[model samples]
Target chain A: MTVTSLPHDAALSARHPGELGLRESATFDRATIADIQRAAATGVYDIRGWGAKRSVPHFDDLLFLGASMSRYPLEGYRERCDTDIVLGDRHASKPLHLQTPVTIAGMSFGALSANAKEALGRGASEVGTSTTTGDGGMTPEERGQSKHLVYQYLPSRYGMNPDDLRKADAIEIVLGQGAKPGGGGMLLGQKITERVAGMRTLPVGIDQRSASRHPDWTGPDDLEIKIGELREITDWKKPIYVKVGASRPYYDTALAVKSGADVIVVDGMQGGTAATQQVFIENVGIPTLAAIPQAVQALQELGVHRKVQLIVSGGIRTGADVAKAMALGADAVAIGTAALIALGDNDPRYAAEYAALGSAAGYYDDFQDGRDPAGISTQDPELSSRLDPVAGGRRIANYLRVLTMEAQTIARACGKSHLRNLEPEDLVALTIEAAAMARVPLAGTSWIPGAR
Target chain B: MVTLIGTETPAYVPAASGATATLVDLAESTVRDLNQALHEPHVQGEWTVTNSDGKHSIAVGIDAPVSVTIEGHVGYYAAGMHQKGDVIIRGNAGVGLAENIMSGTVHVTGDASQSAAATGHGGLVVIDGNAGARCGISMKGVDIVVGGSIGHMSAFMAQAGRLVVCGDAGDALGDSIYEARIYVKGTVASLGADCVEKPMGGEHLEELGQLLAAAGRTEQPSEFKRYGSARNLYHFHVDNSTAY
Candidate 1:
């Protein structure tokens, strides 16, 4: 086989079947050939796939108007767009006061390494937003690094303590996450090292199963009592948030309000997780676009729209996505996968290495195996060393600034001084799926079947 | 009986020995003042309370060896965290009665609500009328005797405790029962998971006699039937599916 290099701008010529070619029977599909080449190089098991393949509806089908209605547009750079968010206004003496509406969602310490969590916290702090701790108890490192911290109260009760509650700026009662709505978290046995096992109070080298229900309460009234207990423990200084996956959001939000929550976090389908069953991730809950309006409507019906802030999550990737979500009535947006991307999950510099593993850039979601070439997902000492926390945090901060800027630009173009002023009327859906799910009018039409 | 007029004084100030304190002045005190007075140390004496007016969490976290008598109804968590104290309510008590008690005596003349005597350790709780669901749940070392019917899932997950009920018990009476002695005088609605009726032996009768006496009941031990763990569902096994 003869090989020759091509010019920078040269076009390739078509070759005959017999010219510089082997037997046609020896040929293979591009994917199969790539797999064979990777196996020969790495000597690992057969190549397996990761992440979602089913085409779930997303925010791409929606569009935003730019100051065409009965409103005036703000100057691009001169006008101000406030992104402040206050959580837990119902009962907290000192609510969670954030400088920006954008915050980091919960990602467990066991799932991601300690350094990665710290980097996330630091980056969020640099951008004046809050960072949350996940199922693996509150670490002092995370608390000290973040300007504001939201501690998650999960079903597993891992690392839960009264001291941590007193120390946290806010407490989020996590009923469920969007990735696996009714399912519990399962840390595979291979990832359960001595430290991870010890932090979770489980036996080493065993798959840890988190219980679905809380040990203390059963229903809404009991939830009120539990909230009282937490308040008494914290001296009512911190705010309390109730987070639920987008399954029956109306009733869940109403119950949360009755249970005396100051904030509501509604996570929808397409949220990221360290590990979850593929079936649950795909089929459990509604899309984010469908969940936001329902939750906002619930709060509005209760006359507590701004009183109880609603933060939305799941599949948020761009600044345009953030603007679209706020227009639909989310007080703020939280990100996971995009944050990981900013921290170098699929950098093109590792293209050769990813190709060697039969994968490519932007397709590296196999985080549970501890072999991430980008150094963000792996627990291996050498691979993890490739990540510099300070540098990664700066990159994430830069990305966050860009997202915030883009959101503000859209808000200004919509004749809104604040991001919150980007109302639902500014949006129209391009597809029936989006139009029905988002409760908005279809493009080039005045029809909104669900509109009142 | 100490009278509290303002929040400056603790909610409950234990009386000195041989002193009788009338709680008539406590009628006008706020909940905050009452809590503060009750949390104060070194106030131990005989106390008589009148016109409780449905106050909740009264006499909570009291560890002194004092006797408190309430003339009217009480609200939730009454006598919670009582240690070495005796509290008597002439009227009904709300949920979580005698919650998390240790080495105390709580007597309710009227019915008690759900979770009565829940998670109490080393206490004697007596209810003159019926108790609600989850009665004596997660009890560690307490001895509870109810004169009327007890609700479902009573004595659930109890560890090292004794529950004696003179009237009928609701369904799943002893669900998830563990190492606890349950005595019932009337018909049971149904047995719970890992729970079954056990034959009353002489030693169990004696134990029942002691529990009944501690609960201030004059009933004979022979009138009651004993129940305990069936020991079938303690561990997971493939073939033992019938027990669970």
Candidate 2:
């Protein structure tokens, strides 16, 4: 075979049949080849952290339609375009009034370092938003640092307590996550420290599998009763949020609303997880941009559109993404992977450490294996101490502030005073797929691809 | 003598116990009011609740060290998250009875629905009759004793606990169980993922005997079989994980 060095992005030239030539097969890319080889060497499929890396129609495919001659735009500096949102105003006696549309998503104390969990709490608190407790339950540092906290009632029920339920500003009943919908969560033994083990009531070092479905209830009817039970337990004070993976968002949203959810959190395919099978992460669930339209349609059909708040998540990074999500009829948006990055995860400064672990800084996805050099996803005392919660918290808070400001800027450009006022009319899609998924008109055209 | 509280219903307060016995009737009092009364600070008493009539969430979230007795059938989550209390339900229990309980003793006189004593931390749950599917699911450091048969998926993902079943067990008996000892006396239909029947040793037999005695059972400990994790998939070993 003949070998030639070419630019990374340059296309391979076709050679005559007589000449010695080979072209990289489109069906077998480098990643697929490597995966095949790896699977050949080992019998098991890969398990990794983070979300889907495959190319899909995302928020980047959509663009905001700024004000024109027909419409007037608000001044960027002088205009007071509000970003405030009210969650769980439907049935909750005391609803959460957030100053920003961005809230921190759930990441467990066991999956993350205590410092990282505290940092999330501190950051969300600083930004007048809420941080959630994940699979292993609430930690003292998180509860103390967070101004508004949302306790996740997951199927695992790890370290769940009634006192903590009362302590929370809101309660989120997690039915499924986006990364691995209808699949259980996996926490490998290496990350299970004594504290984590104690909190979860497991052995010091053991693999823990969080159940896919809830233990008690099998269907939506039982869910309605469970919600009632929770309301009665909390004296109808704390807002109840129901979260679901973005598979069948239309039906899920309708059922969640029927089950008396104050807020419906829809997590899409691009959502991050601490650990899951790579197959599930890539193959399962719909995209965030696609999930929102169906969820809104469901809520509209049920005649409870804004009464029960909608929070969309998965691959949300910048202010533009936040604005787009809201324009698609979401009341709020949640950030998980981006929030961890703001807390200094995958920083290039730890390049050497990551390399030693057979991975690079940008390529570090071994959160389940637990020897995270970044200190955010590990349980090692020495490694965990590398992170200062206060400093990390400040960084996250600043990032959140920037995201909020950026979203406000976009809202003002659309001539909308409040973030919620930015409707679907203020947006356009760059591609046919995006236009169809987002239910928005094509750029420089009046037609939405899939609209009847 | 019966005393009225806030013109709602007549509550029977036993004078013999010197304000220690507070009898509540579910016919007149709501579960919310009863739970509110239980949550009151420094409220120490033996709460005798009558006419439950299959109501859900009876005596839920009781934190105090009080004794609660439900005279009739109760519905789902009958002592859920109960902390430091002695709760006795005289009749059948619905789904998720004593779920997420922390440091308490809950007794169900009749049969229990699915997921009995689920995710409980540091508690003792005794069911006199058969338990439905997913009993003791995700149990954490809780001791559960069932007098009769238990349905499928019992002890699933159980982190740390002892599930003592005096009678037969259904399919997928200990699927994905973690470190929790499942002792079953009667027939076992099947074992689940990563779960295997381990030989019953002296310590296990003695422990089973003690649990049986605590559960007020006459079954011999020698008749039981113990099951637990095979320790595969502990660290994501490629070849070992193929069985999953």
Candidate 3:
């Protein structure tokens, strides 16, 4: 198509090869990228679960105020930003009190290896937070190892008992998770070994399906009865929490309160699952940014803000992210993937082995197979050994400490005395996506579209 | 003392002192008084009731080897926390009947509601009629035998035990059921997330025969079908989504 071309010297005159050359000059918008991707693909890649692999507009556009205005900055080393969180209200005789806001979310014994679960509990305990048992059932090792344990009352009622309820520091009624809202837990047959199967009380080597609804109750009123039953079982000693996915969170949060839930755990679209329908995970729930503000609004309307703690979780990766979440009105944050990372997921050291398994370091998505190199997702004896519980726990604790520190740093910069004082007014959004989702003003402007 | 006025006695009466006592309280008090009067270290007796109305948590937490009889319908958690007791309900029982029973026998003369014999450890629970959802859920060492059909997700996540249903089973039967043997007579509507239908051979038939006999149902064992795990989706494999 080109009849004539300029000399190489002339063509390269405007820029250095190292600067804005082929690599740097390559610019394509979303449409172009999509077109290229479409043309390049020979076949569809079948994958399960929620979350966007490609970069999507997230809460990154938001920034925090460092120590400046009305707030005094805490000394990074000397001064403390309190991380303790008390879940549930005064009605609960034994509320869930944690030393850190970063609690471990539920991962069933059947979905994850026993060692992995133990490591999670150990690590969370080391960090002064809580760990939760998943749908399979409560194991003595898990309950005994964790300093503070939250027992999950799932739809399937697996391993649920009054003794465990009484022993637990808190009770979490898992209405739904963000990754698979309106869906149930699924443990395929390959993962159901004798031990795993035995733990769940199913025949060894069978696919385990969890029901979508609780057997005892069908609606919100019934939920109250269930909560009452739980309270009776525990003598109203333990805090009762209701966990729901981000879909229609405002209504769900309100309903949970109506159902006498002491704490509300709001899980957003970015949350992870051991295994879920690919369509359900990615398409069913709202983003965390949108869900948080609505959840806060619901609690505020109920005049129970801060009394009924709101724990928000989904794609929380950095200290800044944690700070932003808190500023947006989350009492605390629970992390799953990041915690797994701190426990050594996608480590560069395992790059060769991951490659041998037809996966890359960061692309190791085979969590349902139980062949995890990180030892967090597998039941295999050898793979699980790759993770040392004590060492892994130490690393997680260190990471949590860093996240808390970073959050405190920003909270102080915002001129707030405590992390909770870092309000939404202290931040602005850099992108329309975040501005709308987070309900904040655009950077360098006072305009909030729906604000009165 | 409250006396029965007629042949058809009322199902229940709240205590005069306004205590939140269940039917089990009366049963326990009766047993305790009987044992104290008898002055015997232990006593074994079979008591039968002709009519049982909906009564909650009947025969709860009984430790003695005494037989309890209920003539008609009963309510939630009947025979709850039963230890070394034999509870025979002549009619249908509500949810969580014989829940968490440790080393006991619970015989239902009629159907059972949801979660029948839930989480019972070391017990024999026999339901003559249809058992609702989550029958034998999370049972540890208990053996549950249902003469009729079972609802959805029966025996869900049972850690260790055996469930024998003489009729059809609903969807997600044995979902996440672990190491528990389930035998059904009619077709299972659907296997649970990881569960699969397995061949019921001579060994399974023998085991089924024993369970049926224990439940006081010695009918033909050949009519029952077996279900178990396929062991495919235990780990986080990329290609295992089909089973999930």
Candidate 4:
């Protein structure tokens, strides 16, 4: 039982693992060993925030082909490349007409502070986009700040109000998110403040476990009746959105449409959660790149590709990701983890405080602890007050502008007048796995791995 | 076989509340049309629906201060999301009867399917006949009075409200119940995790009596037993794994 240990001050010194003739086992990794020890010690699996940390083939593996010798290109600065998108116009008389195709995804108030929710609303409103209210139901601050608010209809039905339903711009029925496809929401007792408890109708400082299955309805068959009921309740005015984790994308999308959804939101594996089992987050659901084509194929088979809009989410970051999603046949893209980043979560400016909490700025994922140094994911009055909603909103608006502009730059270069016009023909995959998932041709070749 | 039981009229009419009620025949028109008429902002007086042969969503989402009477059997979500209205179903109701009701009253004279009055924020739901599984599930601040027995999982995860059952309760009665109070006059099949029997004090008896009277039931409060949450599984712990 001889164990080779590092020198006592090796971390402070210049000596490296490789230099010390040591090799780290990829299978029996340090992180894996630590995780085993953690499980053995606590007898409970790790439950934390954020999405899948493992590497998967993503949008970065695909490259865009700018207009070349045979094709033409639009002027970068002057030519009009439209980024405007309309969602849920099929049945909704009042569909959301936004200036950009990037929208903010639903993040609950219990997971994030009220200030953060307000900031997200203000940010989305500034850019003529929509923000959504999550499981704790709609808060006044969020509703007041958001111009176009989508009230989420979760199984919990916490703080669900008829008055708020009428006030919302649209209704999104959430089947599951990508982080934990079959799991329910978790707001540990530490984060459950008096206000959160009042809203959730639970005792103060109690761990709230939301139900995974909806109380009334079951599968797609019952979902159809449920959608109809909602339509009747809202007078057929608000758009009905069906959101699902990207597991069986084609079947889910088709079923959603059959269930009378005007809009379908598909969240891929990289989608973030406030708090969930680590195993579930990493194990369930497919990646964003693989999900788009299947969802699009379903819509295309039903002759409602763009008619019944598709909003792809989970790990969408830069304008490239947005453009890649649209090119792969999504009507729009939603940002959750990236939106929190824009709101100053995990910022290096809070490095000292995050380190004091036994986490670094970029590595902090203990959102369930409810002691966020960035103040974006905590309910503590002092911690939440650190974030000024107005200023945070400005940062988000700026980030959104960058993403939209970068997407427009690519669209103009590809000779597309509108973002929706960008197609798979303009894309080439850098890797075979990516080509197979994206259903695109490999770089410098005419072959699509799976199709060929 | 789309038979017209009555003469079809426009979906929505102007504000007019006469002694003669607004008559809507499901066979003559469609469920969408009936709902549109109910949604009319200035709607007043009573609405009488006929030929409701297991038609779903009959007289749903009535927001105005009005009364509706469905003459025949109705399907799922009858009088759902009810606010400021009084709806009476003369026959059996399918699943999700009066779901998410905000205010007003929904009375189902015959038996109801699953999830009756589930997630109701506020209001009173009276089921004169037996209610199927998950009746009053996740109820929030809504009073549900069942004259007959309720099936399995009744009052499961009920948040805040009073559920008065005049007859026997099926399996897992009041499972994971929160602040909601359940008073059952008949024998219970089983108690769910974290749900336990509690002695009915004077206040509970008074409350049960009030609810029974409001629901127009003559059941004596003394015959009923109260069940509530034990507050043990409220916080997460390893010892509660079996309960979970």
Candidate 5:
């Protein structure tokens, strides 16, 4: 005497195929099937924005060992926990002294709207951290709002001038980004506004292809001379930072240091991009959790570990992520995708709008389409006005404060007075994969899977 | 007493002309001393750089409307990013000579190495002797007049500038170039992708004549063959995938 009710339409029960007794294959998953169909439908490969969506070893796998019996914890609000950091004192006369170690990574004005750029500058400035310029070059809106601006010197040299070079707080020589290390970025004609075209010195509404390699120098030997040229251009005043995508972290870091870099910025594969092939994004480069130790080892071997500052970036989100990155030997951590989320990307309020674009709220990553509902990644004047720069700046400033406070809380619990003092000894990996990647011991065991 | 004229104290002597003369001896002081002085505000004079024996970045980033003459050969990036300043290299120049020059003139009396006047926004670059590979590569708005032959891949991706090569051009000239015009008096090995030999018209002749005259060359504009972008590879297409 079982009363089974099946009153709804077939479409209403369509969410799960498992109810039909169809076993889902892990190898050829639903997402993979859709990807194959997409390639078949369109002759072009899938181009989207965002970091690696695939699961891999990351920071969440590592847990902090808070003080219990052996060490005493600092009183939550009574004892002090500092988070200040100084970057790039190796060659430059002036170095950046940040209140918090967390800085904003490079995002171009063209990739983001003017309002978004202004908001990022305002937010980073409010928290006494540095903001960076990207490929398209510096804009007046961003330069005006940012307190400490680090200008990026790329291969394209778009909108690059002597006056702008001298105006920067620090100069970063960008070799590659984390999303696609050996590949260049593409800005579709839809996003290339008149202003962007003017800055880049390209045709209006033309798709611009950024060069992968530098036009002037050839190799590291030539890079050394190029560094000297930049130093001579600014009269050795601004700090020179060399940024590389995480691949051969050990060799790349050592070469950067050898090339006379005041700082090395290693970006992992989880780093976001304005536009890139989905395959390149998912396949290329290693993870942030794995890159830090290798970079640290290289710097330490060179006897200039702390001297040459290391700023790691890719998938930094929360305070725990920040603290964990620092404990792994990063002088500082940079945020990109998380910062955009804080500034209202993929917001639930724009769920309907995202659905119209064939995406959901949290699933929207078409930064290349230039039809961003959140007003952050679009150049449309009406959509750009949707995000009030002042309001967005405040939200991000609050988020940054929370991040800093949370890191401080973790540091206090770890019995460390400073965030940098939370070393590898205070961290343990929850899984053998993370243990091997982070080079830390697995949870209760004293054995690291990879360590000899 | 060995005196570092331009490094410690700038020796400004009133020449016969209205412009003052300042001598910078690289042997006496470092290149930093010379460049630092040139970067200072209100720098207006005729400067002479002596003993610049293959020094890199000697007299780079000069913004003043002064004239700098390097008496000897120099290494990489000699007179890079100079604006309003007229830099003259008396001997052979090494890699990246006058790289990213915004305005004014860079004249090399001897052979210049790779990437001469690369990414130059404006002004004129005159090379008297044969230039190495990638001459005027990615040149933007700068008029480069080479008196002798240029090496391979010359004028590749040259944008919005006039490159007048008085001698023969090397292989793959004007590869994937945009908006720029090239006039060569001698034989080209081959044209690169998206580059073709355009008919030399009246406007081309006059412009080439002016550039040649500016570079102080006697080659008639009629003898030169004009080349430019075929406007094929400006936009990407799957049909033209093999060219890239």
Candidate 6:
């Protein structure tokens, strides 16, 4: 085959020998150019918070197929629709029973303030769902407030203790995160407070790099041994959840199941991070919309679908997103960035403070700096005092209520009694990418892009 | 408070101190049953687990300050996440021995497998024999001492406390270590990441001496070389990519 230059590239190359203007077919975009210049100016790679900013296939690319002439619709006001869910029923004596499928995602205390963590606990408790503790370990404030708490067992094992493990309602073994799969966690010196340092047994004001791989087990076989150890440690009382970034959901899900996990948590490309290299955040892992079907297929192929619960996270913003995720076979959905917003992370009310930080309310993503104007992601005492946990908890509770109600509304309109009953047949994709990923038909047609 | 005499099953002997002493024979009891009996509220007693048979996760999640002695070889994660207890393993231990321990003491009389005493906090762990790879990995405020040589990557990313290796250390000793002090009496194959050899100052000598005493070793502090963090990668810099 012959390689032919595009018209724009040919025209640009014709004048590039003396031109001061940018090339029409420039390989680097404005953002890429900025990143390159920044890297050249500062030797270190850029580290920040938040998930993939560039657009990809997402829930918005799909829509629900509402009841029409051929299908009878339920009365919206009189119909009853359920949104309840149960997790960890496989082996745990006491499983998690939630009023809704929406639950809080894991966010560490060091990355967030004590008040913010408390708010998450309170909000999740009010809705009869669960809240999770991230990398640094569980805090007293979080445990006292959350009705059901899931303790994260990361590769770092920071502050991991038997007492905390026993106190946890469930245990989540973190393999990786969506923002930076195959990458370690980073907590800059600025965020390491005295309490945080003491808890993690690190010196104050020192940067910490959590290990990417677990110290004990290496592969799936070793993982099975480790899972048995965890079960014995907890006396087979607490449920074990294996969480992984959605890079190879099918394989990861199968391995997790084989390792005797009671639940599987898949976080996709859009999952938020407290701090990480910007390149890893922007260019790692598959999208949530694409990860769900792969994970479901793995569970189904293993004959463990719904027997082992699946909780999908990453850029899940609304009740519509939750409904779509469940319709695609996710048992539940988790939220992090959106929950922070409910707790006032980037409220327009903090616009003046955001301006002082050289950013706007809606555009802020520098959670790693620990100078957050909204006080949600800071270790500074004065800044952390700005947030009120009680009020924040109330706001989050209201948001959760809205999401549950909206999901119920959709389920009723679809003539379904339970959210889990809203199957893939009740949905249609607006784009070929979403259609293929979700394994659903395209709008106004019976054609599926890549179905067997 | 009942003692069963020697019969077809093993005998349950009670201690003279009047504290309830529970005897668990692995030949007849399950790990779940033993752990459940140990976790009972207000059950303050001594526990002796016999015939461990190299089983993984023996005497794990012990919350109260109890004394537990294992008579034979134990498998992976032996005494894992132990707190407020004294656990003694009479035979060789498997991988991740005493891992993630908090506020407890785990004593292994024989050789230990990989990742021994990893991520422990507020505890003391003593391994009388050689330790495998990643010994004391990510240790936090937990003092660990290996009476014999240690395998590769000992004290990797250890955040605090002291690691005393009476014998030689394998390659990549103390890789990416932070704050934790390492003392090795024998040769070190290599250093890794941001780890380096540091001068054993007067304060370090005193500290090493104390760690040696705690680990029940009579070796001279001066005989060991001290290793610690170089503080090069403490803060992120692209120039430090080689260390990463």
Top-scoring candidate (DockQ)? 6
Q: What is candidate 4's CA lDDT for residue B10?
A: 25
Per-model TM-score on C-alpha atoms: 0.68, 0.93, 0.76, 0.95, 0.95, 0.93
Q: What global local distance difference test value does model 5 have?
A: 0.89
CA error at residue A446 for candidate 4, angstroms: 2.4
* Clashing residue pairs for model 6: none
**Weakest 10 consecutive residues, lDDT, candidate 2 chain A?**
A9-18
True contacts kept of each: 0.00, 0.59, 0.22, 0.71, 0.38, 0.73
lDDT of 2: 0.88
Ranking by DockQ: 6, 4, 2, 5, 3, 1
Per residue, candidate 1 scores C-alpha lDDT tens digits across A31-96 of 457757866775432312133334566678889878866868999889788777777777899987
Candidates ranked, most accurate by lDDT first: 4, 5, 2, 6, 1, 3
lDDT of each: 0.77, 0.88, 0.75, 0.90, 0.89, 0.88
Compose the digit string of candidate 5's lDDT tens values, residues B24-139: 78889788888998998998768888999999999888888988888899999999987998988889999999988889999999999999988888889999998999998877
Residue A131 error, candidate 2, Å = 0.9
Question: DockQ score for model 2, please?
Answer: 0.61
Predicted candidate 4 versus true structure: per-residue lDDT over A160-263, tens digit per residue: 87678889999999999989887888989999999998888888888888889898899999999999888877878898899999999999999999999999
* C-alpha root-mean-square deviation, each candidate: 9.3, 3.9, 7.4, 3.5, 3.4, 5.0
- A-chain TM-score per prediction? 0.87, 0.95, 0.88, 0.97, 0.97, 0.93
For candidate 4, give the docking quality class from DockQ: medium
lDDT of 4 by residue, B118-149 (tens): 99988899999999999999998889999999
- Residues A373-431, model 6: lDDT tens digits: 88899999899898899988898899998988888788777888888888898899999
Report the poorest 10 consecutive residues by lDDT, candidate 6 chain B. B1-10
Going through the candidates in order, their DockQ values are 0.06, 0.61, 0.20, 0.67, 0.57, 0.69
Each prediction's number of clashing residue pairs: 15, 0, 46, 0, 0, 0
